[model samples]
Target: MFDYSKLPIRNVLCLDMKSFFASVEAVERGLDPMETLLVVVANKNRKGSVVLAASPKMKELYGIKTGSRFFEIPVNNKQIHIVESRMALYVNYASKVIQILEKFAPYEAIDVYSIDESWICTDGTEKLFGNRWEVARKIRETIYEETGLPSCIGIGPNKFLAKVILDIEAKKNGIAECKYKDVEDKLWPQKVEAIWGIGKRMQKNLNRMGIFKVGELATTPLNKLKERFGVMGEQLYWHSWGVDLSPVIQDWEFEEEQKSISTGITLMSDYGGEDTEIVILELCEEIGLRLRQSFLQCKTVYLGIEYSKDIGGGFGHSHTMNDYSCISNQIYKECISLFRKYYQGFPVRKVSVAVSNLQNFDNLQLKLFDEENQRDLSLSFALDEVKNKYGKHSIFKGVSLFKNATAKERANKIGGHNK
Candidate 1:
């Protein structure tokens, strides 16, 4: 008889690059890996841009991690090196890695954590790949050989445990394998914060209740955890015990069931006052490009603005459109209209453009009076062809020139290996 009380998940592979960005830079510059130099890089100005990546060598020197501010490091009398970040290079490398992973497993089943890390289902590949451990080793080797990027992999019964084992506990033991029997020995010794789902806010909350370790979290009452964190709390409760019910999905096309399309950018510096409107328009244009690219017509435009250094709160507004559209000009105008209402007093650090309630533009039957409809459809198809044949940037909408960094990066990445 199948046990209804038990959580069931199986055959997960967690793959993460070793100090991804810094490693990529080291490869690019031919830097000595043994050198005691801390490499930190960001978007535009070193101080202004969020530290995008740090090498393992750099991590030891300055104790810095990705997304840390540049100025936070007190000048340690030791010599340190800083490099301006190149997001484009990182994205290109990331795309190649994804392409390679897809050949081994279905794309939807793979969960992307960032530019350098992902998790995929290994259940179906055992026959073809021999064993799970061998599969993990092969994937790691392939990534290292192709990108000059070293990867650490962890295989376990579930995705959550697989990833936690890879990033946290396994690093100390070289690599970790969590079988059904070894779950208690392998996972419970780690601190509560060491688990993937727990963050600073959640950690602080758990710590207050004397739950300082993963073992303690595993033993906590599920009902109490649910009360404390609601549905997400329940997730944490199960995850601590090496339970993740999610399947190794081959595609995220199912995500379309919920309406969403978005574009976001972290600016080099705060654009507070007058320039805010211009930036919003630029962001809207880029969002429209993405919307058209996906062939999605949206009826709602939402704007989100985050103030620099303020994690507590920010401004946001949503507007319901009179009609649905993937047309850039129409979306731009609607975004501008929404911006006029939502853009308030704040020195914006990050901006996001989102459109929801999406549908097919052809089926929407928008009014013919709008020239934007015809223009956008024609342009989108052409751009799609360019991207398909030459790559994602073979052609881009003019609006992207003013706003999108990916477009700029695509233009810059002249020659690189792709398969």
Candidate 2:
């Protein structure tokens, strides 16, 4: 039997910005996102465009939320506001929100998970912050006062429990804490999919074994799960019991590990022919930019294509590079080769590019007869300098002039949405 007392218990806080995009839109207009009935869409002109964010009122009253299509929004309603996304503005505000969190936990204790979520360790701050629940409220209130954005907080002993509690209970209750004693009543009733690590595909597998509730999964034989799903299956069983040993990795500590890096985009219209190359190059370039920022290079690339769901099929494949490289041109070359190999002639609505098996520049292995590779590395380094000092668009390649190039349009976007 696993000894609960042996687990490493740290007070981790999972913070989520409620309807972040819509909230930023409302704040920019001097309205409260919690009170406003608003939905932020990627594009106002495209009815099929995805909803970037929806305000709390809009979600509760209209059942419209993120991923809701623009066409589904209630038009002609004077009370409801449907605004186009301004991703740059949201990112700017997100930074300000971070400033507020830094007041409690130093930057080393905070892990910025996404544009709107973070996990913070408050393990040793009881004297300074009073208690965990109080600190959570303070963060929630401080963000609202500083940036006019509402936030939810989940407190737990580790990252997984904190994140899952925020997703299931904190967002609605405002703030929720999951101590070890609260596990059965607070965590068990939720469906498997509602938990943080489990997804739709995993839900189906668990259902096949009649494991519907979190409670059942918590008590199932660990060996059976390990036999079924292997290492990940073991993780599934542990996370089901609200146990997580992962640390909250600070932004300053990102370079130590080589997990993965990826970039993807959903096009406004289905692309065909040469246009696909233009989009793929832009995504690879974006992925390369991120890799270079981390001072890392990758030895594997993955490409994913989503034919419109209406058409019924999509494809994804990965290839390991013969030589590790972080040059945008090199990554693009590999992706184009993959496109040629895997792409079938279908209207493509989305594209994804990923680079993995990362290594820091200090540890990179150079070739003996590799002048061209050296030049590529030097140029990529120079480009990263300009991008960091100026903006991402301050430097551009000839390929960006392609007719379907979207890099210029998205230069100011945070995650493919306009700003």
Candidate 3:
């Protein structure tokens, strides 16, 4: 049992754009977002293209939701409109949404969770904006009037509660509030998977432990949870009780000294053999460029390859080098070593590369005899300068010109979709 009276309580609002991409398309077409049957797909030309977003009507009528294949959409449906994703446009709208939030709260008091979701702390705005509910209404109405977009708001005492309420209740009711005292009555009966942080695997694990509902998780002994799932289990136990200590207002800028520099992409089509190697090289180049941009170098290089979903297994492994470097070739070499060692040659659908064990670039120790290493580092910085002055594609390795390479095409895209 915990003392709810002693817990710090604050006003947190989690706002999520309704069917963001599809709604944006609907607004552009002058159609009501909620009434329009729209679907945003990554590639309208490909039958297997994944649906990125589907309007409420589209979902309800056809069961076409995000991750549904393009082919699943009813053919020749006069009411349904299929559109390709325009990430740049969506990002612009997301920025506009944040600007709206900035009017009511300081920028530091807002956290942009994704392109379509954000959390704003309304702790001290009661005098200007009224209570949290009033503020939520004003925000929702203002966003719709200004941008022709619809959103749902969830009000709670903390971030987790706000987000959970938003996902579970506000999406249907438009606006909902969940207080600490309401956790048991409002959230306890829901399945464990309904919680924000608990995924399918964790739900399966909890189910095996006979913890099927939020109340069960809350009532379970802390020691038992800690013994089973370690720190995460402790967090789960606390979260179930509607206890979240995360700050509502904090620095959100990318940290200069990051824990890791990573990049990943899902291939539009399966890639294998030398083609997969080329993809890996491009990923390394991205990681190296990011490290140089941040003035950081990493000692550990990690590579992950996911086989096709039909096959459904993948391998991720990392190798720590003897030296820290931001050179693309060095990272690529380490990544390639890992890929070759663990790769089963299944048609690879996704590839990811990461570099960790980071330190400041200024801390790099130069080897007296390793002049080639110094040259490679200098060349990397030189290339970075060129890319900065011109563009990302202005200077790329010769391998990028290969038929299987995606760097050139990717350079023109935003978030791997059309700009």
Candidate 4:
């Protein structure tokens, strides 16, 4: 019962590259990106390392998919090629792809969602580029021709529709469109899970309510949905109608401010209790610096420890405070408390920490005991300036000299994996 006549009808294209990482690797090796069987892993030497991407043929023929471990990949499959991740090379290719996209739309109209996907608004470009369909086809062809990255294009009147169509339909057809007029026919028949935002847990809840299809959820009372999912339920209802008012302006930086700051590391080797605490202290500094970098303070701190596979079981716990903070030592105190309370003393292979329930640093109130707090804040600010001007490792923690320290190793990596 929403007013369809009043909604803006813009031509948005959500573009996704097919098996981006694996395809890029295949093309780099002079293999047919479409026909080749390849898998990208962080460390091929580590048998348990997860696969980042798998080529189409590998998925179709061998059932090997992204997230499958190295050992899970069939060694008997002589056709498969295993390659280590090269994030810098892939990012360079993505930048070149961005240059190609700029030909059709300006930077403000483009939103790069991730390493492999983007949304471009071609609202008024139909005058110069023929039509939206033709523009999509041309862009798809131009990308494959110049960079050898096969792409799928999903056309819609808004960003959400474009993304869903790209994820659900264009993935099968290479290029497809879902209009507001066609939402009933195009989006309703799919399983609830197939809709972009409805994950397994939500789908399960909907199933309990006898809502197995998109149409059922759409038709359900707004109050019912809001009761179950709060504001998100309202969003789902509008999304079900293929409605989105957001612009494609790379708004992610400004629109989604940091709600939390965190850092985690999987130790190359198992760590004992004392060594784990030292690593946690180092991680606290990293997290606190990130909070300061973003000008955020957090009221809740989270700690997670994954025991070595041989030991089994892991624990995740959190501590919330009335006072918001972004100081490293204060954060370290909470993390250590949580660690001691729940840690089973098993050999730990991985450790993680996060601070959330955020507030701006500008809003942080000065404490009654301002003398020590000011000194700590001043020292941290000075260290941040030094690191920003020089290099990250320009200054190092004394504990970094400790045997179990991962700060130096992580500084040299990209997203905790080899660069």
Candidate 5:
């Protein structure tokens, strides 16, 4: 139903590091990443800690994958090496891999999708790198040689096709290519959930509509799909036909005005009563700091609390403030109000704070007589300056001194894992 001749077809390569975290640990210990039975857990000491990554052999033999608890692994297996996650080490390797990609493509042509995955556009580099297949092989081999981490490459005409092919085929074959013409034969036969963006919930929704396969979804009426899923349905229809318009090269330096600034943490242990309030204050501090850094102020504050698994459910509510603010205490005051009103006093395992309905700092009109408001704003900026010059942990609210506050510990982490 789409015109193949009218579409943008460019050489896009999707690259993924094999068992990234576990492989990094294996390589550090002088073990073969593919052959070694290794698992990377969030915390080696915590039995309830989640498995973050597992080597190919570990996954194949023990059925242990990411999200599997530490206790699920086979006990006392001499072949299995369980290691705590070293986010800094993994990030260093990821940076090296990106540098390797930069050797083959310009920085602008490379988009770092995640720590261990990326998309490189090689539209004009075939003459320099031989061909797309040659470039993919060179990239895969060079990454392994330099970082000792195996990689897979999927080549296609755009980002979606490349990523889908990478996830489905390249991981098995090391490298795979899928062109528009190959979509029907190669992609359509796969289940809808196998598509890059479709999850189990989406799969069930499609199943109820009698669209269980990619081809089935592709053949369904666009108007009908759009009627049901709105813009997302139109996107699904186009992706099924291998017609992605997303640019392979992303401009990372571009900054769009943000709608919200937020932060959250999953506590290592459940907190209650006053401890939960302390956590809320820390989160508000983080959100407020982010807002000030971006020169934004928020009109709404939101708090979310997730109870322990045993408790099963929790609450999330937001309150619009009388005025916009980038002050931590102001945000915290609104969040605490929400918490006090909604919290059922169950043990809290996770907490989040957010500020939205943002406007530029320039839009905030100073109240001439409100000296307290003026002083608070001045003090917030002064504190930000101190923290920026020294460090995040260099200066913090007194509430952070509370035993339950994670601000100090989190400042040392990368993505909430050990650095």
Candidate 6:
């Protein structure tokens, strides 16, 4: 581990959104972020729907995770206001943020680490943007003005320390740049989990080894870590000391491949019995609409629910079509069937639909027993075209027509009630 306590660390800036999805929704909806305990959830009423983001105050009260729900909040539990996520809107804001970064820093030398985090190489732009600290502040203010998102930036000698300082201590100190001068007294006191990419599982593993904090991780033996975790251990050890040699690379291609597109919503209230079936039906239609829009066929569809308050604890059930399909009805029917098998009478707070192992619809073989199957496929494609041109929900299936149903409730939450 590289110790920067005495040395001056510079030429690195880590820019991160405070609460990306929730902030975008708040700005769009004209909601006051500081006063509200807002959460970006898949479904407003669902109990254990994934909590994409929340305000800082909410974090202090609830310590929410990605899959936490509104009802789980212990303090002012009734104060939880769930907002349904808008992927398109978030992407739009994220693009603007990237544009601001490009205007302030070299595009290629900037690394977009996540949806809300990016690392910019400030080595060359110091003169133009001013000293490292001034440049970071300018970037932060520019992003805030352009996108209305609060960002805490950290500057260090390398990307690793920059990210560590930003992730760990910047918010507490109200500092823009976290350099070597502040490492021992500032960064080293924080918990190990504060380091980016050091999640719960890794934290647990580290804890078992008697490594509890940043200081402990810094002092742990490299040979022991390497023996236990291989290359990842080595990286983690180096990360503890804020030693990151990885260059900020531009043109970083995202790894997601879209064979089928799907979304989920957690209800503000839990549902069982027939209501659960209705939610499943709504998810099927949503997935079906998305599938046709992308011009893909999926042989597998899954319905997942998280009834637990804790993260990473849930059961998912999936069904695969032996014959394979692009037809929405087929996918929907199979999805419902799978749900029936998995429901087990447990109250569901969240519902999700996903289609995987996709194939091009043009290559789909026509069925011999069902003459209408091919016709149904064409109709689905036509409907997809209409929805794509007019906007989603302009046309919806009859099954989802019920007013104030789970689908509508979740949509309102995601669409945001204000804007």
**Top candidate (TM-score):** 5
lDDT of 3 at 233: 95
Candidate 5 weakest ten by summed lDDT: 361-370
Better of 1 and 6 by lDDT: 6
> Candidate 2 has what TM-score?
0.79
> 4 or 6, which is superior by TM-score?
4
Each candidate's clash count:
5, 3, 0, 0, 0, 11
lDDT of 2 at 362: 64
What is candidate 3's lDDT per residue for 1-419, written digit by digit as tens?
A: 56899888899999999999999999999999999999999888899999999999998999999999999999698889999999999999999999999999999999989999999999899999999999999999999999999999999999999999998999999999999889989888888999999999999999999999999999999999999999999999999999999988887774554698789998888888679999999999999899888888789988999999888899999989997888889999998888888888789999999889998756436444178888887788788999999987797889889987989889878988987
Q: Write the per-residue lDDT of candidate 4 for residues 210-299, one digit (tens) a residue.
A: 999988888999899999889998998888888888865655456766677778988889899999999999899988888888888889
lDDT of each: 0.70, 0.85, 0.91, 0.88, 0.90, 0.73
Number of backbone clashes in candidate 6? 11
TM-score of each: 0.76, 0.79, 0.86, 0.80, 0.90, 0.71
Best by lDDT: 3
Q: Residue 122 in candidate 1 has what lDDT?
A: 71
After the best TM-score superposition of candidate 2, give how far the Cα of residue 296 lies from its true spot, in angstroms: 7.6
- Candidate 1: what lDDT? 0.70
Better of 2 and 6 by TM-score: 2
Worst 10 residues of 3 by lDDT: 360-369
lDDT of 6: 0.73
**In model 6, where is the ten-residue run with the lowest total lDDT?**
410-419
Residue runs of model 1 more than 4 Å from their true location after superposition: 1-9, 32-38, 72-81, 95-110, 124-129, 249-255, 264-274, 304-315, 335-352, 363-367, 370-419
Q: lDDT of model 2 at residue 258? A: 63
